[model samples]
Target: MQPITPFFMFEGNAEEAMNFYLSIFEGASISHITRYGANEVGKEGSVQQAIFTLNGQTFMCIDSPIKHDFTFTPALSLYITCDTEEEIDRLYGALSIGGAVLMPINAYPFTQKFAWFNDQFGVSWQLNLPGKGEGF
Candidate 1:
């Protein structure tokens, strides 16, 4: 397990969200998952807990058995440093579908290219093409 990992709680779409994220990042994978059983409060087959790796950063997610109005927020977001403009563009496009863009991809003084958006699952992400000798 990673020393520190982000944990997400979804109403019922944990599996779907996990797969969607895996599809977007290369080398991503579901390391393990434990689903709700017949007698559990959650619907059978729903994710009780899951461990996933986005490239190499590990994350934990679960399908919350109880309802809550809260969700992912922009205050805290997944920040990715892209290798090229094409990569940032591709990620921005794919993640922006069915979602909203907080900052459209464009050339910025801090970075050559940058974009910030919330994915369909309401997860906020910031993608950037780092400038020389710097990280975004």
Candidate 2:
């Protein structure tokens, strides 16, 4: 079976979103990108299709030609297991900006430190610093 990669569809700002994520995570890079040209279905210079990696996980994204009423929701999220409080704190501070926080960063009964929020691009994310012997 083929690997299932998470995909994102943006109206016109996929490149911006991809760059934003790359700046936040270590070892992240764009593997390939195809931009729209003149007379194309999508906006000129917008992302036609792209593949990128974040912390070793591959993801795909595109700048959609057609606009849709629907967008990303908190139901499906990118989960990150951070190794330290500093990592979680930095990530939470960076991701929470210009976004809505479903759960602010704090200690929870299930974990030592955790946060859940939707990024400016409407992508949901959860950052967790798990305690010893704990897993999520």
Candidate 3:
């Protein structure tokens, strides 16, 4: 089977969200982007499709032309295994702003530090620092 890449659909702010993520994560970059032109289905200059990588994990996203009643849900999240306290703290601070926290950063029995939240763009995320954690 081909490698599966995560995809995201944004109402109209896919570009903004992509840039925001690139700024926050190390080794993040936009690999490719196709913007809507004048009179296109989507808003002019908006992302029709974009490919980006965060810390080498590739993801696809788009500014959807069709408006829908639904958006991102917390059921599926992007999980990150952080290397240090500073790393998790920085990511949690950035991702949790203007978003709902499902679980605040704390030491749990399964992990030394962990947090789960939805980002400003409604993307769910979980940050973990494995120390005493059984599963790494």
Best by lDDT: 2
Please tell me which model should have the higher TM-score, number 1 or number 3. 3
lDDT of 3: 0.93
Off by over 4 Å in 1: none
How do the residues 81-103 of candidate 1 rate in per-residue lDDT, one tens digit apiece? 98887888888887889988998
Separately for all candidates shown, the number of backbone clashes (residues 3 or more apart, or on different chains) is 0, 0, 0
Candidate 3 wrong stretches, greater than 4 Å: none
TM-score on alpha carbons, each prediction: 0.93, 0.97, 0.95
Provide the lDDT at 102 for model 2: 95
Q: On a 0 to 1 TM-score scale, where does candidate 1 land against the true structure?
A: 0.93
lDDT for every model?
0.90, 0.94, 0.93
Report the poorest 10 consecutive residues by lDDT, candidate 3: 127-136
In TM-score terms, which candidate is top?
2
- Residue pairs with backbone atoms closer than 3 Å in model 2 (clashes): none
lDDT string for model 2 (1-136, tens) is: 9889999999988999999999999899999999999998989999999999999999999999998999999999999999989999999988889999999899999999999999999999999999999866
